[model samples]
Target: MPSDVDSTADEQSNGYWFRRGLAGIISAPAFILMASFVGFGGLAREAGWSAGEAAFITGFIWALPSQVVFIGSVAAGASFGAIIIAVALSAVRLLPMTVALMPILRDPKRPGWVYYPASHFIAITAWVVSMMRLPDVPRGGRLAFFLGFGMSLTVCNVAVTLLSHQLAGTVSPVIAAALVFLTPMYFLVALWSAARMRADYLALITGLVLGPVFHHVDPEFDILWAGILGGTLAFGLHKIMERWS
Candidate 1:
């Protein structure tokens, strides 16, 4: 936790983001991002991506789900427009993430356009840390901290992707696949942290139950159906739970 200081004393400086950005690399949870990206790198190459392409995806796209959608669609021979639409659809989850954290990271002096580019970096690992840590960080330092944090993840992931890409041939498929599990595990834990209400708890439980069943029945649209039906069930269950109590 960080100490509270007079906000006026903490007013903006160009250097504020620089200092916090460095500190973000050493953040305790950051290794989770590194591990997740390392797995992502491995999976990308395993799925037939080149080192250059993997690095580009990590650097620019930055979202694991979007990257997965892009690669999966491309491999399935989806059309150009389809690939873009699929990737964008998979990335819909990010809007809430960006909207949720903007207040902490937005700076009045920087103008709104800067935030759009800044929002590009709002993947799950970094977003979780920002939600948790930004409140304690000085108001002026949040954007820099976020950008720096993102930079650290980007730099490390690029290197990790290259390294993992090399290892893709030598490494067993099982081992490489195991590494890729880190990202989802991070999301599950973070979801647990965020699921404080009855509705949220029900929704998570519903997803856990329905997600696999949906996949078994219809693999193509499994996740989409799981979200829709699971959410509806949870919403109904939450109402029941509310009335029962």
Candidate 2:
């Protein structure tokens, strides 16, 4: 349907694609992300964050993991420098995501500075959706579509965070915690659905196997080490298999 639409005169208009992208909010991933942020709002309240602070973090950071690390660190009375380091470490994963996404969204006619703000929207949800959807869109309209989807999602979630913060006390801790798991579940399922290569499957499986092992070894940096080691091993194995083939 997108390919059919792209072949028409609407292909030339950014506004058309942008408005179409706005429809992403109605999708499953969007709902999952909103639910996760509701959980985040409850977590923030339990951590003693103000509603304004929670909303600000949601708007600016936009990465749920980083927001969690930030609030967790602050609540635990970590030093300012330590909080910054922890959050930055948690968010470093986004750099590669942005790099992977830029080729699809970049318009050579536009200046590079335009991508800087767009980069802020490069969380897991936006990146996953854009990677799947942008190839079908005309190159000229990809940025507009992404901006429409990402900006709208971010705005809506910010409001959700604020509202959830106000109603945080009403939600039982167990349910709120369960809500937070929905995003990762969606992410795993989406990745599986989108996988096209053996290497992709290998990487995912390796990460899954290593995650708990690394957690048992060192809880503080489990995710970081698991991801790095698992991804590197998968990549190396893929290369070896390719050479043998």
Alpha-carbon RMSD of each model: 3.4, 4.3
Give the Å error, residue 206, model 1.
3.1
Residue pair clashes in candidate 1: 17-144
Q: Which segments of model 2 are wrong by more than 4 Å?
A: 1-12, 171-245
Clashes, model 1: 1
The digit string of per-residue lDDT tens for model 2 on 171-239 reads 677766665555467557756875767788888899889988986997655656776788889889999
Mind giving the per-residue lDDT tens digits that candidate 1 earns over 197-243? 78878888888899789768875555556767897899899999899
State which candidate has the highest lDDT.
2
Where model 1 places Cα greater than 4 Å from the true spot, the runs are 1-12, 72-90, 181-187
True lDDT of residue 27, candidate 1: 63
Candidate 2: C-alpha lDDT: 0.81
Model 2 lDDT-worst window of ten: 1-10
